[model samples]
Structures are given as structure tokens and as C-alpha cells.
Target: MTEPTDLTPSGRLPVTIEEEMRSSYLAYAMSVIVSRALPDVRDGLKPVHRRILYAMRESGFTADKPYRKSARAVGDVMGKYHPHGDSSIYDAMVRMAQHWSMRVKLIDGQGNFGSVDGDSPAAMRYTEARLAKASSFLLDDIERDTVDFQPNYDESENEPKVLPAVFPNLLVNGAAGIAVGMATNIPTHNPGEVIDATLAMIANPAIELDELMQIIPGPDFPTGGIIMGRSGIRRAYETGRGSIPVRARAEIEEIRKDRQAIIITEIPYQVNKATLQEKIADLVRSKEIEGISDIRDESDRSGMRVVIELKRDATPDVVLNQLYRFTQLQTSFSANMLALDDGKPRTMGLKDILEAFLRFREEVILRRARFDLNKARDRGHLLVGLVLAVANIDEVIALIRAAPDAATARESLMAREWDASEVVPLLELIHDEGNVIIDGKVRLTEAQARGILELRLQRLTGLEREKIQGELGEVAQKIGELLAIIESRPRRMEVMREELLAARAEVATPRVTEISDALGDQTDESLIEPGQMVVTITRDGFIKRTPLEVFRSQNRG
Candidate 1:
């Protein structure tokens, strides 16, 4: 037997185990940071979210169309684009549909999509969904080569790297994710405000943060609440990191002759109403809070309303303050503002994000213009061939009759030089560079010959001929416009502004969360209601508070 050659040349390089582990861990961490967790700066979506929208749009599940089963969309995304678990993909889809979760809902869900009270959404098999109308702004012009595409997991299809997001979706809807060692917690802003800020930045790239803050006051949560102060907003906008305090909107009113109750119309964003009520009840039972006699959730289709009845002598203001201190009714949203920029994690302030989006939008507009320009030029080239053939209709028909087969006639049409005097001007008008006029004569190209031979008998009529000429004229006009847009920078910016305004009309809405100047100044002592309580201590140094009624008065029992 022939000696076996060294199949594994050089074998292993003898890398240290420490080095291997370090390098492998870094690769895994980067994969999580770039591909799985962070949102893209342009489209403000993770891979799973992007895949769902693209798959739904591809499947014709749009706003105008009727809703399809959510399971269908999830399956398409998982099979075609994202190769992840169905539960994770469905969870991402469900969040896009929840109004309380997203500032501007991207999906129009037809069935139960969970609630702010921490209820779980229905299974994907039971729900139906379609792309929302506002999604058109993000998905429009996608097929016109506005963005880059790469092969899917199995190379069976291509998927867009980032959407052609016409507006700043990141700021409008916000994002939240946890990566290997970093996390993002961006707060949502008003659409109108975000658009106005973008337009303002377009008008003046050097605008300061204070001026931007004037336009965009603060985050506008879908669940309307009161922001305690503006300092946090300023700090976040300036540094990309800060905590904003939010409080539920509560009003004290007399429910009966002398019984007063606290009415909660809106809770802090992401807070569960049921959980808040339970906590209040626990506090009341433990005597840590003294005022509330009863608690009930009266929420309905109209709106949210949670009533906390006060004792006859309890002060409404103090009791409300105590509840705010101890319950989820008041919470702080910590803003991290981390996202993926150019395939790397970055911490960006407001200005950085807007600047990046503007740059990307300009690139999309340029790419789309080039694509449309190419299409128009190709169409104009075909029309030129038709105009030439119509000018020489008798010669062309006689030549076709003389040839035995269509291929022979096509070859003959390509071989002979025809008079270019009539069609030269049309070619010049469309700037066609395919066939050059030599001594006032030109030869037909393969494509042009095919277009000519494929013409119908009806097209030989005077009216049909004139219609073709008119269409050629329109295509030429479009070509000229697209060329101008491609050549001029200011003109491109103008187009961007126009498209942004159009998107604004569909996305803008009135602000929901109100910003207040009042400082949150409740102390720990004030958090406890003024009432009698029993404190218990164990040998292990554990302490607990119990209501005084736990031990009833008795005679040596």
C-alpha cells in the first residue's frame, strides 16, 4: 500500500488554552453585541424585529390587506431570515403590536396582545397581525435598491441589512436590550417632536442641545404620566445616560359625603396596575401605611382608573405621597442610549444619533435615485428602437416577410445599418449612449431588435405610435430629474426634507407624558403612614412589622 501522505499539514499551532478561551469568549460576546441585542442606529431594530417586518411585507400582510394568522408571519421569518426559536420571534412581534410598549405601534394586532397589568399575550396561533400604515414610511422604496442586502442563513434568499427608514425611528419608538456586558435603555419621544428636531438639524447642523431640547422637551411614554423634572432629560440628552423619575397621574376626590379616595388615571410606563394595587393592600395590612380602607381597579375600555379609598381622618396628600414612595406608582427609567453604529456598539447622545440618521438617509436617497435613473434610461433606449422601427415600418415589414424564421429576421435587423436622421434627436433627448450615430446611420442592438420584433400589429396604428412617443417623452423627463437629484447635494437634502415631512404627517401625534418642574422630595420617614404598629425581632437579627390588631386584648389567655 502506498504510504499515506500527511493529510493534516502542520497540525495544530499549539495555542495556549488561556488564549483560546479568551479569543472564543470575545467572539461570542461580539456576536451577541452586534447581531443579537443592540438596535441599528438607522432603523432602530434588532435582527429579529427587522426579519419579521420584512417577511410580513414580502407576504403581502400590509395595512390595506386583511390580517393573517400571526403564526404564518413568525414561521416565514424563522424559516427565511432569522433562524431562532418561534417563541422569541413571536415575543418580538407581539411587542411591536403592543401600544403601551412601543410609542408608535408598528404592527396592527387583531387579538389579545397582553396588557399593562402584566397579563400575557395570546399564543401566536390564536392572534392575527399585519403591518401598520406608518410602517410604509420605513419599508417604502426598499425594492428600489435603497439599502444593502446579504444572503440569508441558508443562502436561499437575500435580506436587507437595514431598512430604508425615512424618519428617526430609534428616537420615536425607543429601544431596550441586554447584550454580553452592555445594555440599552433608550426612552421614546414624541413623533412630531422627533421629526421637528430632525428638520431643524437639517436646516442647521450646528444647532445646540438646549435649542433641541426646546423642540423636544422630553420622553413621551405611551402610558401617559408626569415626569418629575427636566434635569434628567437634559443630562440624558447631553451625556446619553441619566435617570428620569416618572410618577403616576393621581387625583384625590371625595367619593362620598366625607370619604376621600385617590383616583389613578395613568401609571408609570411599564408598571403593572394589578401589582401596584396588591402592594398597597399589603402595606395597609402590615400597618406600614395607615390611610387606605379599600382598593379596587375600575379600569375599562374607556381608560384606566384605580381607586384607593382613604380612612376618615387620613390626609389625602400625605397618603398619596406615601404610596408614591413605596409602590411602583413612581419609578425611574434609566437611560443607557447604547446602540449599534456601523456594526459596533456605541453610546450616542441626541445630536450624534440625528447626524448619523441624516447621513444614512442621504445615502438611501442617492442609491434609489441611481436605481430609478438606470431603469428610465433602459426604457428610453427601448423606445428609441421602437421610434426607429416605426420610422422605417415598410422596410422592416418587407425584411421580416423575406426571412424564414424570427431568429434570422432578428439577425438581419441587427446587421443592416438604418438611417438615424429621424431617431437621433430622440436619442439625444434621453441621453442614450447605447447606439452611436456614424455618418447618420446606426445598427440595432440585440435588445432593441427584440423590442422591435415583439411589437404588436396594433402598435403600428397612428394612435398607438403616438402613445409610445408620449411615454418615451415622459421617461426622458424622469431621467433628467433623477440625474439632477443625483448630481446635486443640496437638491438631495431638499428631497430628504420633503420625504421627512410626508412621513411626519403619518407618524406625528400629540404628546402623552407631561414634564413637570416639581422636584421629587419625599423622605423615608414620610413613606410610612402615621399609625400604630408592632415590630418583631428574631434571634437571627431578622426584623418585621405587623399590624397592632395581630394580638387581641385578653385577660391572661
Candidate 2:
């Protein structure tokens, strides 16, 4: 071998290529596993989001079972899927099932998990559960090949990095995660709309994102309230960042024939129910509002019923306005639509989500379109072969088997000039065979061969084809919808993505020192009077090297 050449200059120490290569490769691998693959505490999931489903499944929470302890469900998930602590697992499961926590809760519980007090859930042994109809619906195809699976933390178990997650949980249920230098926070969404969007994405490979948004509108909270405006929703969807103002619902309640109380039945989620109750109590205590009667928790298993009894001579509307103004009873639901995209933290507005979903929708379309096109091409090729085989049936069988190769048989038939049309059907028959090929016995007519090609390549009229077409239409629609989002400026995710990339860029920059060269400008001004030092500070600027010479005496002209 020739002598090894030195990469470094003569004065510099020799650097081995292997050491540098090892360090760089090691860094990339660690970054992918820790920042992209792992789940955060907010979701309380690991590689698998199984606890949410497993807890519901184990708690006897079947669509048929009576509602039971959410706590027990949590316990099972912790013991089996989690193998971590009990509290957080139980809490995550509860949140996934809670109407208050989710825009559309996937689980339906019959018993108490915990109140809005943010109290910890009970131990798993004390709780019980079963699968909800919704959970079962989502998990319907788990056994089928609709999704892929990989090994769990240990080789002993297997986990799904993602379930079929067919509804696009990233947009519907939303998500939040934090890694070393990244974090994601996505908002909740409506199930009906999300399902519609998912179906749309599956159909058309080129649906516009804007069209998709028309179906989704914006997030529909489970509390059954309203988002104050459309503009913010649009902004959030486009830019992946925006907030919506939300208000609590209140109505007049009659205690007696003449006495009335302004009762608050529902409060905005993230609004403190107990605190609102206390605030009202405090109002009663402070005599800020002259309410004549009692304050009691009439809330029960059915729902929240806050009874605010009033004096026979009270003004309900005025007090309602004040409550709305002062409390979270009516507050802003800040929709900081943020989430993880390709292993980085990103903030999205509604438009951003719409745009991202649109892009994803188109990708699925392209994949399906390619699949369909290739399928059509195969039938076209077979149609040609069958035509040739049928024309000269006798010689074809011998040629097919003894020739030992498809290409050789094809060559032999082409040279013979006997009926090329007949050979086409032979090719087709071989392709459709359940058992054997080139048997020579299978026969066909020119009309029959033409008919098969027409039927196979023409797109099927069968139920499966119709279903696939419908899905294609939906995906196409979504692609169209997302494209429309571009008009709405949907692409907040791009902004967030840019920010994360900028952060990464900063990481690559040298961080040795930040010494200001302006320090040399310092001049002794100790004799200057206190509060009269006459300092000329560089206000509202950076790289502020305030040279001592730059400062002028307060009295200096």
C-alpha cells in the first residue's frame, strides 16, 4: 500500500478521520432518539401511546359495560404499558377521556376519576374500566396490516410508534411534547370534522388544504361553547400560531314565582370552576353584589348545576355582565397551536395546521395514484400477451413450459408470426392464474381479451373501487383545501419551523465569548454627581460598545 497522506498542515497535530467520523455520527443518532422518538410528560406516553387505550380497555369500559373507576384503568396502564409511576399515567388516561381535557374525549367513564381541582387520581387497585365505543372504533384495524409495529423498550415487548391513528390525531386530538431543544403543543379538535378530513385526505391525492379547512372550520371544544371569531382561527391555521377568545355560558334561573337567580351551568375549560364558585361566594361575602339568598353546589352525576339564589329584587343581567368581565367564566382561549414536526418544536396557527395537513394529504394521494397507475400498466402488458397466446394455442403451451423463461417464450412467439393477437390472452391468463402458468390449456377469444383489459384497466365498478374512489376524492379535496389555505396564509408551521432551524443555527455558532469592545470607552466619571452622571446610554440597540469617550458631561455643549 502507498504511504498514508496527512490531511492536517505540518504545524497542526495529526487528526484521525475515524475519531471525527465517530463523534459526528454518534451525535446524529443520539439527537434522533432523544428528541424525536421519545414522548414528554405532558402526554405521559413513551414510545407507545398505549396507556390511553390500554387503561380504557382494562377498566371493563366496553361500550356495553357500566361506567366504573377511572382510577383502576390508570393502574392497569401503569403496571402493564407504562412500568413507570401510577399518578401521571392515570392522569393522562383521565385527560384523554375527560370532556374538559379533550375537545372530543375518546373514552366514556361512568365513575369519578377526579374533579377539576387537578387532584391526583386514586390508585389502580381502587379503580376499574373498559373500552369505550370510540376507542374500539379507532382500534378496529389494529390486528390488520393497516399499521406497522416495532419492538418495545425491551425486546420482550412490541410497541406501535403510531397506531393507525387514522383520524390524524396531530390535528384532531392535538399533542404536546418537549425534547432537549424542541417542544410541541397542539390544540384539541372536533371528532366529526376530523373524521371527515381524514376521509377526504384518503380519497384524492391532490385535494387543496383550503377545501379541507372549510369542513373543519376550527377546533370545536367539548364544552359545547363557541370560538369568538373566524379571523384568529384562520391566522392560527395558516401561521401555526393564534389565539381565540372564549366565554362562559350563563342563563337566568328562577327560584320562586317572583325570585330569580343568575345561574352559571357551564364554564370555559381551563377556567377554574372551584375558583369561579369562590369568586361568586366572595362577591356574596364582600357584599359587592347584593344577592339575597344562598350559594350551593347542585352539581351532580348528570352535570354541573351551580345555584346562585337571588333576592326577590335583584338585577340578573347586570351581574351576569360583571361576572363575564371579571372572571375566567368568560375568558380568552389562547390557541397557541404549536406542535412537533420532523423532530423540532414548532408553533402553528390554524392556517399552519391546515397547510401541514394539506401537504400530508397530497403525499398520500401521490402514493395511491402511483399504486393505481402501476396496477393499470400491469393489466395493459398482460392484455398484449393474451392476444398472442390465443391465436396459436398449440405451440404456446410447449413454448411456455420448455422454454424455461418468460422472455424466451415471448421472443419465440414474436418470431413465429402466427397470430400475435392470440398470444395476448395467454399472457393475461397466466397473470390471473390461481395455481399454474403457461399450461397451454387456458383459451380465450379476442373479444374476451379486450373485455378483460377494458374492465381491469377501466377502473372497477365494484364496491371496493367505489370506496377507494371516494377516499381518493376526499384526499384530493383536502389537497385542494390546503392550497386554499395558502390564500388564507396558512403555513404558521413554516414560521415555527424557521424559528427552530434558527435555534439550531445558533447551536452551530461559536459560543466562546461575548466581550463588548465598547468597554474600552469607559472614562472616569466618579466626580459626576449622583443622578447627574449624564450617561448617554445606547438605548434600543445592540452591539452597544459605549466608549467612555462617547459619554459627554451633562454640562458639556
Candidate 3:
């Protein structure tokens, strides 16, 4: 054949390149936005992060348990849930364990996990990890059908769609990511403050932003530093985007006679100490900044201390100001509160995130109550069957003896009806539907008959019989409590509040970052000495500054 006929469906219809490219690019962008880059508002986790936590929990690597090699957990996540590269999975897991990386670490690591100086972490095979106790709040009630589950990539296993987070994890531990055309850079907040804000919202659904801010002041970076002003924080909370200026904590100290030095204890969030030192050194070498006699890092286990000794005549304040102006001693954090909400990327304010978490937590509480109710009802049904068998012990024994086998005896038990007068009240209390009552008699269900057959001879003793009745009464009470939680909204809310308080007790800590009202503007004028200078402009328009003495007065210059 000269040419093969087109076998494609739609008769190989012709399409413009522009149309195809537009559709394909849009598909790819959505995939990245939903599947990878942004965190889910409910759990504050991307796919890789969620997978790592879930996998580690499944492997029994909890905080109380012994730590296992990180590579093992990474392998489990990649093979079962995430289906990604091992390096990416390990990197995500390591970040969760790093104290400086997460506001509240989700994982407790035993080995070295990098440093604030931007050093790389040790290999995953050498490091060990386990789930932190705080994670229990996120993972509790997961097995009770509180959240939905979807099949993994290869359809070989199932994983949760989102964790049944008790607290508002989205704001408590924040998140950062970059997608196709968007990115999120939400700063973390103190756990105690976040929980308080959530509780306040619950108490007053119509609470305004002003009232909420009173509870949660501003972002609390793990690397504690002073926030210069409140205006940026207000803008971010109101509109989900703003920049806050942060300055390192430094003090002028006299280390010798007639000489002073600058002592830096803390740096801006996400700023590397080593790089900052290098930048300062380069500026001094190029003579851009003057008066520094020596620079040394005296940081140790106690805390961070970068010492900048000054010349005898150098003004400590002036040199420190120059460092702030030319180095990373001062920086601004640009907050972009972007995350995935209901499978779409959204820019959410503080109120939007808290509201979403509340809605999700309510659903979790309802689902868990239903699950417990069903379980209690089932146990009560079995106990009722056991009681009947004990009441008619003589007849039951005779019938079993006459039967040829266990199967025939079970069928005979199912076929016969017994007096319902003794158990009718218990059945009503527990809401059990395993048996049917007609007039004054009821027949045993298949499940009940099998349970009776499996009963031991010792259960017929007087004390044992009394024990069974007592256990049945406890189960009945439990069933009624679960029913109330399911039927009434207020009862469920009370239960949720109690659980939240319990979680708060475990993870709450005092605020680390300090918020101040001092204004910080970008300028070098204040760092200059209080003296006159000569400004010269060339014919070509370049300008330069020189000391007044450099152009000494002459006869007629």
C-alpha cells in the first residue's frame, strides 16, 4: 500500500496547533496545581507530605515507639502511596522533622537533619524518624471512617483523601510551595494562639476580623525574630498577601577597654547565617562598608552569636546600621496564603482557613459518632443472645445433645422461638435489630445462633451469668450516649471541644516570635556620619559624593 489509511476515531479530524496547545497546557497546569504543589486546606499537606505521615503511622513509627531508619519509611511511602522519587519523599519527611523548618515538627528525628546554615542533611539510610505526639491529633479517628479513602496510583492499596485533623493545622504549621503559575508562602503561627482563635470562632460564629486578631496576633516563625510592625500582619490576615519586615536581634557590647563590638543573637527567618557573614565580609573587603576590625562566629550549643569587632574610633551604632543596610541582617517575609480548597487553588485569609477547618471537623465528629453507635449496637445484640441462652440453659443443652452436629444444632436454635419478655426492655434500650419479636416470642438470628454455639460451658456458672448481665448493661449505656451524640448537634460540639482541649494540652507552647511597632524603612542616610560632603555631577550625568575637605578652598577654584 502506498499509504496507510488513518485509523483514528473522529476520522482524524484536523485541528489547529494553537487549539491543541491551549488544551494540553491547561491540563498540565491543573495537574500540578491539584496533585502536587498546593496543600489541602483541611490537613495542610501536599500529596508527598501526607503520604509520608500516613505511611510512617501505618508502619507503627509513632513517637512512643522506637525510631526506625528514615529510608524504610520513604520506601514504604513511595511504593504504597506517593509513587514518587525516593529523594523527594525523604526530603519532605526530613523537613517535617527539622525544628527550624516546621513550626511544630510532625516527625521526631534522632539523627542530624541539616542545619540553619543551609547544610545538607545526612543520607536517609543513616537517619532515624518516628511520628511526633502532635501527629496523633491529626491521625486520630482515621480508622473510624471519619474521612474518605481513594485507591493508590496502581490501585493496589487505599489511602485517606485527607487527615481527620482536630486542630486547624493549615494555620498552626503553615506551608510553602510553587505550582505552575502560582505559589504559597504562608508563615507559621504559635499553636496555642491558633487553637485559641479556633475556639473563639466556635463560640461566636459572627466574630469579626478584629476580634479574631485579638486572639491570634500574627505569624510566629520557628526561627524567632522581631516583626517590625502590625500593619503588614493586618493586611495579610485581611487580604491574604503582605510583606513584613524582620530584623535580627543585635546589641552593642564593650569587650575591651575603649572598644565596642556588635553581638548578633538571632537572624531573620529563612536567612542563612553563613551566607550573611560572607556578604558582610565581601562588602568590607570591597571597602563598601568600613570600621569593622574583625568578624567571627562564636555560636555554640547555647545559642547563635556572631561577633563583629569594631575599630576604636568606629561608631558601633553606625557600623551596625551599615550591616543592616548592606547585609541580610534585615529582610522582609512576603506572605502568600495560597492553598488548595475543595480541589481548587485559592488565596484564603485567616478566617477562610479557620472556617473550612471547622466545617471539616464537624463532619469528622458526626462520622465517628455513627461508627461508635453501630459498634455498640452490635455488641449489645450479641450480649442479649448470650443472656437468652443462659436463661434456657437446660433446654439448650438437651437440644445440642440431641443434634447430630454443630451445624444442625445452630439451625435448630434459629428455627425455635423463645420468650421475649425478659430481653425486650434491653433490646429497646440498645436499638438492636438482630432478632424479630412476634406477639410474645422472638426467633434467633443466624449470627446469634452461631454466637450461642460458640459459647463455653463455664459461662453457665452463676457468677459468670451475673457478669454477662453486668457487661450487657454497660454496653447499653454506651449505646445510648453514642445515640445522643449522633442525634444532637450541641452534644457533638461539646465532645469536640473536650477533645480539642486535650490536644491543646499536648502541643501548646508559648509564643516565640515577638511583634513590635517600630517602623523600619529602607534607607542609608541614617547610617552616614553627621558631616558635610561635596556632590559632583559629570557632564555625562554620573554623580559622586566626596568629603568637604577633598575640595579645599583655593584662590578661585
Candidate 4:
């Protein structure tokens, strides 16, 4: 009683601190990797995102449904599946609804989610949300058992481990996250382009990366901008990591007499426009960048237009170059295409990601077909029982009339043998082995016996009996089709392709960011045209430029 244990329970073995710490740290790292940071390669969503979508779908917050209070969704997700803070869950949900964040937004938000100026979204109480139309692609087959499910953190509820994403969501929307010792920063691509590339891969698995690149040239940011050079795009797509430079789209325009301005229409992806403007102003005040007379934001609902007004004598091209060089007007999107593949984090290239998605989709298709086939067989089995009872109407009715209770009637039905000729072809069609023919007679199973005892009086009519045969024929045909789909690899691939094409048609949009062959860094001298100018100055200290052709040779004069 006086002896003290070393912080270990009595009768428990002692463990080294180092070993315990190492094991604990490893567990933490894996939790972060699987539960928080990385998106599943199948659905392109992290655990939190998957939970939110599943919860919303469960609550009937579908694309066609009316919007519900965002707080309700956040509460349900946190209480049921995600066990995280309400703020973090709401933030993730808000990002999904942001048009500028996700290439194909998954949520239809009814309030100010956020702005490209790095504004924080309003509180969950103020916002309303529902699933977007495109989100159906990921959750369509979830109820059909196309994907597996696991218990929630508390084991009180079930949630999908991964979505049965029919679309190539990983590439279409992309993802970014930071885990314990690793991170991921996948860039979004065009939906149409991604679908075309996937179809190409299906058609020819041996197609080279170069060919795939032809279909999907590079990342397409939701905010339109220019992606300079293909070198970085190639590196990222080939090696799963690279730095791609993006520049704002601007044009030099003469605003008024002798005044020029640079009108910026688009900014780089993830860049805060307000912060970018502040940085530019900081540089201007510090004299780091010169020649700016004024700066103003003239952006509106039509489009983005940040006007950088230049002094009368200021060179617009030079000032624009300085802005690009020093401010967020130009930025680099460093892509680290890391994600979870089969619960292990891996850096996947373009082809690797596509191949993994195709494999997963094939499995989903097969599982769904099997689930349908089983359902059809069960229905066909019941219909066979009814057809048998209908064939032997007199004997069945007489046995039921004599029994003292329903249980006895069921036993009597199972005890008696019936003609197997009528249901033999139907059984063969459904491939049902539950019913066996012995000496040209079949004994009813407990399920079939129950079915006969529960039959309604009206179902004994001639019309109802014919209806059973017709319905069984339909079920048998469906069973045959499902079996064919499961057995044929080519047909499964075709199904996947058609589903992907349909999703593409719904979500595909014109590429916003332009990819140019020019390099990121450009000098003002390169933009200047080769021409001669005559400089003139008046005695009053006014200066002007006159074209060389303005003055003719005046030797005689």
C-alpha cells in the first residue's frame, strides 16, 4: 500500500517514454493525414468535406430543395460525423460554396460566403445553403451501395468513407491542405478537358502524358488570369510538383487627354485584391515603384477593373511592369499534388491520379451492379412463390381454410409439394438456386410459404395472376442486364464514360485563365516599338514629343 507506481497502473507493464511518445506522435500524424488534410483520390474531398456533403444529402438539402439555415447543416455535421469545431466545419462548407474557390462549386449558398478580397464569410446564422447540382455526381450512387461506409467517431452513426464520385472531382475542383509533416496543393482543371482526358485514357490506357496534356493544357483558375509558360505546367503534371507563374490580365488604355491607365481585369488565383492594392500603394509611397499618379478600384458586378492611373508623362508600360514585378498583380501557384490513395499519402502525377480514379470507379460500378442484381433476385424469388400459389389455388385455399392459425397454414404450405414447371424458367432466368426441384415438385421455403399465407383475396384473380408473370419477366430481364454489366469490363467502362460525359455537360465552362507561351518576366524595353521621336522643349519649360516624320528635310529653308 505504501509503494507508489511509476504513473503506471498496478499490474500493468511499464513502457519507455520514448516508445510511447513515438507511437503517440505517429498516431497523431496519421489522424491528421487521413481525417483532416488530404482529400480522397476517389472523391477529391477530405473527411470534413465528405461528412458535410453526406449530412446535407441525408437531411434532404439537395440541389432542387430549398435552402436551409447554414447553422443547421453545420450543427448536424459537427454532432454526427465530424466532431470538429463549428467554425472550422462552417468554413469548409463556405469554401465549397464559393464560386471563386471551387472550380465547380458543390454548395449553393444564398448569402455572402466571402469575397476575392480575402474577406471573411458572415456567421453561419446569416448564411443559407443547399447542395449544388454538380454535387449530385459525387453522391448519386451512395445510397445504391456504390461505396463503403464506416461508423462515426462515436460509433453512433454511419458515414461513407469515400463518395462514389462519378465525375473526376480531384482534377475538376482540386484541393489544398497541410498535415503534420506534409501538404498538398492540387490545381483545378477544366471539367470538359478532364472528362475528355479520362475518356481518352479509357480508350487507350497506353496514351502518353503528352497526349493527355494536349487535352488538359494546365490549371484553369476560377478568376480569369494568364498562366505564363508551359514549362511549369509540364513539370507539375509529370512530377506532381512545380511552380506555375500567373499574372493579372491588364490593358493599357488612354483614359483622358494625355493620361494613360492600366486597367486590371483579373487577378491571380488566391490573391487578395485588397491586400494586393495595399501592397502596390505601399510600394508607391516607399518610392520602390514610381510613375503612379493615382490608384482606384472601379470593379463592379460586370467584372473586375482596378484602374492604375498614370501621370501625364508617366510611362504606362514601365509602371505596369513594376507592378507585376513587385506586387500580387503577379504570383506563382506552387502546386504539390499530394493526396491519399488507399489510406496512404502519395504524390500523384496526372496519369497516376486518373488511373486511380478509373480503378475506383470500376469497383463502384461493379459493387452497384451486384447490389442491384441481388435485389432483383430477391424480388423474382417472391414472385415465383406467388406464381406457385396462384397455380395451385384450390389446394392452397383448402389448406389455409383447415389450419387453426396463420403459422400452421405456413407450415402446411411448406409441407406440401407443388408443380415446378411454371417457375422453372423464371428461376433459371434469375439464376436463383434457393428453389430446388425434386421429383418434378418444389417445397416452399419459409419466405415463400409466408408469401403464400399473406396473399390478398383479390390477388387470386386471373388478371392478378397474369400481372405476376409480367412483373417477373421484367425483373428477370433487369437481372440479366445487371449480370451482363458486372461481367463485361468493356460495358462497365462505357457506363463510366457516359456518366462522366453527362457530368461534364452540366459543369463544364469556358477556361478563365489564359495560357501564354511568353515567359513570366518581361521588360518594358521589349514592349516598346522601334521608332524615332523628336523631343522639343519650349522656353517656358514645357516638353513634348514629335514624330521624326513630322519635320521634312529643310536644307533650303
- What overall lDDT goes with each candidate model? 0.92, 0.51, 0.89, 0.91
Q: What is candidate 3's TM-score against the reference? A: 0.93
**Cα error, candidate 3, residue 499 (Å):** 1.5
lDDT of 4 by residue, 1-557 (tens): 59766665576778999999999999999999989999999899999999999999999999999999999999999999998799999999999998889999999999889888889999999999999999999999898899989999999999999999987899999999999999999999988899999999999999999999999999999987999999999999999999999999999999998999999999998999999899989999998887888889998888899999988877777788888888888899999999999999999999999999999999999999999998998888999999999988999999999999999999999999988998888789879988999988998899899888888999988899889999999998999889889999999999888888898889889999899999897676644444687788999999987667764343226
- For candidate 2, the per-residue lDDT at 379 reads 47
TM-score of 4: 0.92
Q: Per-residue CA lDDT of candidate 2, range 156-275, in tens?
A: 555443343323456555665554444454556665565555445445435665877776776655454445556656666777666555555567977789989776666665666777
TM-score of each: 0.92, 0.54, 0.93, 0.92
Lowest summed lDDT across 10 adjacent residues in model 4 is found at 547-556
Instruction: Pick the winner on TM-score between candidates 1 and 2.
Output: 1
Candidate achieving the largest TM-score: 3
Could you give the C-alpha RMSD of every candidate to the true structure, in order shown? Answer: 5.8, 18.0, 3.5, 5.5
Error of 4 at 326 (Å): 0.5
Compared with the true structure, the alpha-carbon lDDT of candidate 1 equals: 0.92
Which one wins on lDDT? 1
Give the 10-residue window scoring lowest on summed lDDT in candidate 3: 548-557
Per-residue C-alpha lDDT of model 3 across residues 222-252, encoded as one tens digit per residue: 8887888999999999999999888888999
